[model samples]
Target: MKYDKKEPETMDADPMRLLVSAILAFTVMLFINGFVGSMGGFPAFVAFTLVFFRIRTRAGMGNGGMQQELSDRQITGRLLWKYAAGYLVLWGILRIAFLISRVTGWGNINGASAVEYVRQMWNTSLLEKWAYFFAGMIMFAFVLSLFPLAVIREKVRWIRYALVDGAVFALVCLGNNGVCRLKFEQKSSGGATCLIDHLLLCGRMRTWQEITCLLAMVVFILVIGAFVFSYASRQYAVKNIDGIPASAGEEESRRHRMIRKIVTVGCSIAAIVIVVVIVLLMPKDTAGDYTKVAEFLTEDTRMGPMEYGDVVYVSVNEEADLEKNGIAQGYLAERGERCDSRFYQLAIANLLYTDPTGKTNLVQTAGTDGGTYAPVASVETDKTWETDDVFLLWDEDWALESAYSHEPTGYVACPADLIQGLRMQFPDVTYRTADFSDYDAYFTLRGYQNMEQALEEDPVDGDWVGCILVKDNKFYFGSYENQITGICLQQLRKVLGGNAK
Candidate 1:
């Protein structure tokens, strides 16, 4: 019997309803895939591939409607290629978005005043961008709504087109979260500035290993699954098509199949090469020291093995600043949680006690105040060693430039008793401060510039004031802008024991 253009009136299933159901099912599947990722152990690539194959197999069987048989001769390489290429492009866009989010604090609503932008985009008001997105999705569905009608009449390629487009739409929706996070960072205080500082001063990326592993897994799974699904769908179709199509339809289908196979082969090779290049380029220096530090810090075992140096100039309270700016707060709000605050005063106090000149009274006042100091000019020393670990620790207000240039280097200040306990532990360590005047001479001789000059002249923040230097038969804190307090000396002594002093 010849197939009719329209279905018989008794047909129970409404094509439009089936189309809506398919769209809704795919959307639900995409949401579930994301939820599975959050639960851990389930790979998104695998989940998506399984969903796609299930759709293809069901479509091939005609959802138990009119039976069809596919032909092996009709399943040309071109069709597989087209299908794979479409999926690959969709995957690429999603990957790029995910990368942006991971690097830039995107979609992390808790980060850097991100909530405002998120709220703006997703608010319930009709004017919100989210409403626009929904409208767009509706228009897209309307235009593609004819896909189910095509599938019902066995115009199989429309089903393929619809699936590819829907998959892309889903991936893009997921990736927009990352893009939103990027928007948040650009708007907030210390957002881009903090990013640039981390780039220049922080030196290396921390999550390189995990990134390499994830990329490797994703590429491997996508390639293997794409090929398997393509070949299986073609075989299933060839087995199922019962009625011969018009000469034109058959010719078109053959040409399409050949193109898809070619695309698949090209895509598989490209995916492999891209994955290899990314893995090879991954950063490998896991624990490289970004700063050079004092002698009292050791590389031995009682404490965890030592990391080489400090990462930046100021150990500012990053968490406090982030919270102030409305960045997402993490476990910090929990009571009694110890924060790894960069105690600059502890280092400053160590410098004070070690200062060769007894007149280094700048260190005494720091003990009474919270571990903060302010910019001070020294009449005794020609110029403050801006990079040294000394700052007036009492000032509630401090800026990044001040700490970078004006502060002196010493132990991060802690309670006085902590110092005494450390001294008792490491009695032999000879921790002492250098003369403030000598620090000026040293910086001049070494061709060093202060923090402000450095920031203005050299954008790299390369011009540091002082370091915990160890020369032949010489061991001492060399920078004098800030004096190392007795408090820091004690902590160092305790850490290094007799050998460090």
Candidate 2:
């Protein structure tokens, strides 16, 4: 009896298909790394390993180019140990590299040490920081590529893997960095909290630019998802097909099934914990009550009667928006005669006051009344002045524009001699002077086309004003509706004496 000759096994997988699979896997891993932040490496490693196994099985490694026929327990145990060992080894290598760079300035180290370099990078532009991170990722990916390449039975060229890895690196770096930078620049403020809020789209989109950027980001994510799915499907024909078991009589062991069940439960618990932690860590805005502070300052006339000869400059804390509480409501009540209709009151509350509550009756009303308010520009000032005051008073709306412009165009209340004297005290500060006439064109350009349409429904004596006053050497800062003008003037008179005109 003669034995039939067995045909030699041949590698039939396409190189291009393998390359595409590798690229898609790496891209997805990078996304996981980015979304979960700096400590995202563990999850990314596990995800990458899982995807690698699927790709390997699809390429016909375990079942002689047909399916994965290995025992479930054997496969799971082997992959876990292999991946964990590799991850720890790579982590050690990176730590060693960090130490070496710190000691010898060998790599991208820019400061006295690696820690200092990281801190400096944090202060740099968002794009620059992401670029640095992606550079490191590329190096890590090169090492990782070898594992997947070895698992495949096909003798594919190394250059193909390298080319695919390079393409993946570029795509992830550009796509993530570009989108993050766009969102970051559109933010009104910058901080860790702001960055997180922007990423999650939790922050309010206040302008057209922010809205457009958000929409673009949504489109970008969808496009990327489509490409990843298309490429992955073409490269790995796993869909609509079942894998053959190791033997005709074989079944998954009870212990192996239990292990998988444990893993599923563990992952679910971990995900819930992460969500709870993130919610707890989120920042909350607190509306400061400055009414007591204001009253305390006003009652302490112990500084003695302010003299016109003694410069009395005043400034309010510009960072906190005026809270819409008793102080705000009281101020509004005094100006009730000027704000004849509810519409004007709503506009004043929404536009002129900064309520940290985020929602107020006035804001809700304004939203329904078809009225819009101009966004206020945040102005920074020196906080060292002793006489800083916080009260609400409305002056011409153009006063803010004039002050920010830094042009000497408006008639400031303090005498020129007094203003010059105060200027000498703070020689480093650049002050802008503006008169009523200087604000005429500014008002028009700012959409105050019809003063009646822009302000109160009924004509008012003046628009609401919030300002910092510099008289002689003192600064008084306040915010209020039109009625606070007289009270503010009274305080000014006490400080200016006969000089207040």
Instruction: Give the top-scoring candidate (lDDT).
Output: 2
Tens digit of per-residue lDDT, candidate 2, span 370-414:
121222111123222222222112333433343576532222233
Off by over 4 Å in 1: 1-77, 98-501
Q: Give Cα distance to truth, residue 331, candidate 2, Å.
A: 33
TM-score of each: 0.24, 0.25
lDDT of 1 by residue, 382-475 (tens): 3232333321111111233345666532112233344334334433332223232122211111112333432333222221122333333232
Displacement of residue 182 (Cα, Å) in model 1 is: 40
RMSD of 2: 20.2
Model 1 / residue 5 / CA error / Å: 11
Q: After superposition, how far is residue 179 of candidate 1 from its true place, in Å?
A: 36
Off by over 4 Å in 2: 1-17, 20-24, 39-76, 91-115, 118-501
TM-score for candidate 1: 0.24
